[model samples]
Target chain A: MIDFENVKLKIGDTEITIGAVLESNGSTSNLKTGAWRSMRPVTDLEKCISCGICWSLCPEGCIIKRKDGKFEADLDYCKGCGICANECPVKAITMVMEEK
Target chain B: MAIAGLPEEEYLSCGHRACAGCGAATAIRLITKAAGKNSILVESTGCIEVISTPYPETAWKLPWIHGAFENPSSIASGISAALKAKGIEDEINVVAFGGDGSTYDIGLGHISGAFERGDNFTYICYDNEAYMNTGIQRSGATPYGASTTTSPAGRESIGKVEWKKDIIHILAAHKSPYLASASIGYPTDAFKKIRKAIETKGPTFVNLFATCPTGWRSDPAKSIELAKLAVETGVVPLYEIINGKHVVGMPRDISKLKPVEEYLKVQGRYRHLFRPEKKEMEINFIQERVKENLALLLEYAETGH
Candidate 1:
């Protein structure tokens, strides 16, 4: 949320300024964390009650409520904590391993 | 770690680098939600601090400051004083937090000084028993019979031989208006206490029971379950000492409660205690101590002195 795009770090033997160091307050969204995830959450729309439990429980805020009253996970950010799958009351969500 | 409800807030966002199913991280999320955006979070150097804010990155949405292992209380008191001096004391909430190593051992003097001076702030200690951030070193708050790197259980020793330092009683003796021992197992209860502590004038404290899955040799998914078992077993009593009156928060029926072994069985640190080579005496001692601790808490709750 705060501007930290300018912060960078060059750790190796090359002249590269990797803006990996985030000295900003709440600058986590800049990081596309999908690649770090070993597994991901997939939703079964038919069984979803739109209870918003996963929406509330997602630590990553990757689960979004669609305009049509359905839910989808922004896999680009979801770390597959399995909290959504664990909290789903109607067995609507499942976590599957990410394919390389 | 599943369908268990967390408040609909994104203060501590993902990709901030905390171990999976970290109870301390969970406690941080809950605290931020309760404290809201218009607050100052002062954290001591520990697992939460190290994991949340690695160099340029930070997980906090609020204005947060990092302090040394023994000085969050000192810095928070100064901040609270400065806020009052600027005539906007009510506009900001000053909160300080750290692990049990910082609270029960290292920063106690500063904490006592702040409490004695009546600083306007809320101090929460997420007690994980050991110096987990530094690779499972024993601290004063570590339970007896729990093995650690420093207090390893072997041929000549039975892990940490000392009982947990009674933090609630120590803080209560300071005559702080609000004090409570919270567990991650019962999050609503923890939230209620944190809100109450924030609202209370002057200094307040809450010692939170946070489970360390790695240090405790526990299952990641069972973090909350182990925390709940702690309260249910009376190993960590839930009570708030307000104005010298000890009020019990959640009372378990001791008659129906499971044995202390139930708590130990889930943890790998206590693995030696359950060995088949006959370590019955240590188990019996730990069991007796757990019961004794519960009986003492019940006494405090009933007598209020």
Candidate 2:
């Protein structure tokens, strides 16, 4: 087995893999796509009815079920698509402009 | 409580580079959930492949392979053969997917060959209408009167002159054991059809209508609503062709269909048909065509052919 830690071999000033193959799966999660957001979805927990429609329809699969049995998006990966807000049957989620 | 009776496990992880509110991404999430953990995914060179696997990063949690745009089906066939050679063909499901550009145009031959050979795999075509990844170029699946970069609606032209290719009928003629048409608008139906397609043996195909907010110039959040409107207006009928028998799904009756204009007026691709002058003739033609298509499917359902 190849040591993933040393898989990248330095060549002068650049680094390259042995065969350019990625052994690690789901590594894209390291990328914080939430930075790409211009709008943020703020959910009202009182009106939110844990129906999971937001979770099911989210393209990023970033929506998580909270401890209170309500659902909200993990802002670390949410791109502020507003799909959850648009699809929320209870109108609990609202899209607000993100402050830089 | 329970996430609407759907699988809680997610195979397509977050933080991938897919566009915000991407219908294809939603479709992929639903598909991977239905395929479960004991499956391998094969993807063609399209939006999903580009976004999901960019260099050393990957969004797929399953064992996935990327093939050329025109040969994912061919690659799937080889994988099926290898699985059979290992005597574990029945233990794993092989799912190959592509965009409309790859499925309805570039990869049609490879898909046909695989189906003709009865390859044990599932081929899904997530059709976003045009080649959105390549800047909205017209493809075989580009609907009639829709403007695109290659088929622009100008003073001299009226968008794509040709009607969208009937890819479902083309695949159905191969006598595949299972074939279905679904849209992201109806998630439950799409999930059921995808599960059925994966469970069925031999070559199975599902044409999933995915919306492109960028290409169509529609509201990103309205992707699912637009998809639903497509079905409600009979623009995209959900149906199944099991062993050469056609079974129409939602919007089964012609009278139940909402006006085709309700679906068309939302997307910017069809905006030209209404602006400068109301292209009454074109709208009428489209409405008639939608009715005719639904009528044909209803007839096929009644005839069982």
Candidate 3:
């Protein structure tokens, strides 16, 4: 058996393995890249319509839909490419400095 | 419930070695999302392969194999044959992917052979318009007037004097069950074409117009926008040729197409064209070429010739 503990992952209750999981879903899901962000996107819940423009166009695949259907940045893998902010059809996403 | 627009699975990982805004990676991601896990991939030497698979660590989750630049199609055919011999050909998709160098140039003979043999595989060319992995040399697929390293634009010349090779017509000439051209900007269309190409039992071909920010000398942020511009301006018309008949996908009305300048402006490779005096003649030539190309496709659609 392989020592998966040596590998980084946030399994979230799925039986996934090295060969089967292949190269996506944040690659190393447990590693949060939030520190890589110099700026972050702030979504106005009221001003935003859940058109999902940000969810699909994100290069990092970091923008995810919450249970309520509104989208938010995972920040874990979002290199803060700002592609979501640029692609947001309604201008609902704005980029701000990562103060924290 | 599925996330409305976001793809559910990630065949391409966030940590892959592609450039920050690599459009070819976007196309690769989208294509893998469509192909699903039951697929085995055959990749030729190209940017996608070099960057994704670095030694022991690989970026692919599928049963993928790397082949020489000129033999991905041959390898795919062998895989398909082995699967058929085992009576499991129907359950798996053998997809061969490469850059324009491999698809339109180096691997053309093998591609033709595979298609002629009616191999059960899909060949996808991630066309960034030049041999980008080999330092942006001009490939057969590079459009006219683009300044690649081998085809530099200077006082003696404007740029590549030859027009873009008509690979689509060549594939269509084989009476391929399915053949289409798509861009990374239009994921919906790209996804559909990828799915269709894989699902079709016989040979299929898809040329995905991938934008290369490094090779094209364009802003990484503008990659998708440039891809969108290519289709919107009819410079890279998105369409499917099925059973020897052509069908237009986007910009159905040719009149709505924007000028070539709109598509050329963002790319650094075409920057010199807009200098002080401007390469008015070349720009006009490109515009006319786009028109004639579309007109010929339209005519072919009507006449079936």
Q: Tell me, by lDDT, which candidate is best.
A: 2
Per-residue lDDT over A14-84 for candidate 2, one digit per residue giving the tens place of the 0 to 100 score: 77776565778899999999999999999999999889999988889999998888999899999988988
TM (chain A) per model: 0.71, 0.80, 0.68
Instruction: Highest DockQ: give the candidate number.
Output: 2
Residue B40, candidate 2: alpha-carbon lDDT: 90
After superposing the true interface residues, what Cα RMSD does each candidate give? 3.6, 0.8, 3.7
Q: How well does candidate 2 score on lDDT at residue A47?
A: 99
Q: What lDDT does model 1 reach?
A: 0.81
Q: Give per-residue CA lDDT, model 2, range B203-244, as digits (tens).
A: 999999998899999988888989999999999999999989
- In candidate 3 chain A, what residue range of length 10 has the lowest lDDT sum? A20-29
Candidate 3 lDDT by residue in tens digits, B1-305: 23444357766655556665577877887778878889988899999988776554566767778889999999999999999999999999899999999998999999999999999999999999998887999999999989999999888876788988989888887778999999988887898899999999899999999888889998766678888899999999898988767888876767878999988877889877996568898899999989888887777777865
Clashing pairs in 2: none
Q: Which stretches of candidate 3 lie over 4 Å from their true place?
A: A1-42, A95-100, B1-7
Score each candidate by Cα lDDT. 0.81, 0.92, 0.81
| Pairs of residues at least 3 apart in sequence or in different chains that clash in candidate 3 | A22-B61, A23-B13, A24-B13
Output DockQ, candidate 3.
0.18
Name the lDDT value of residue B264 in candidate 3.
88
Model 1 C-alpha lDDT per residue in residues B1-305, reported as the tens digit of each score? 22234455567866666665567877877688778777988989899888777665676778888889999999999999999999999988999999999999999999999999999999999999999999999999999888999999998887999989998889888999999999867777787789889989899999989888779988665677788888887788798888888887665456666777888887999988877474788878877887777777778778766
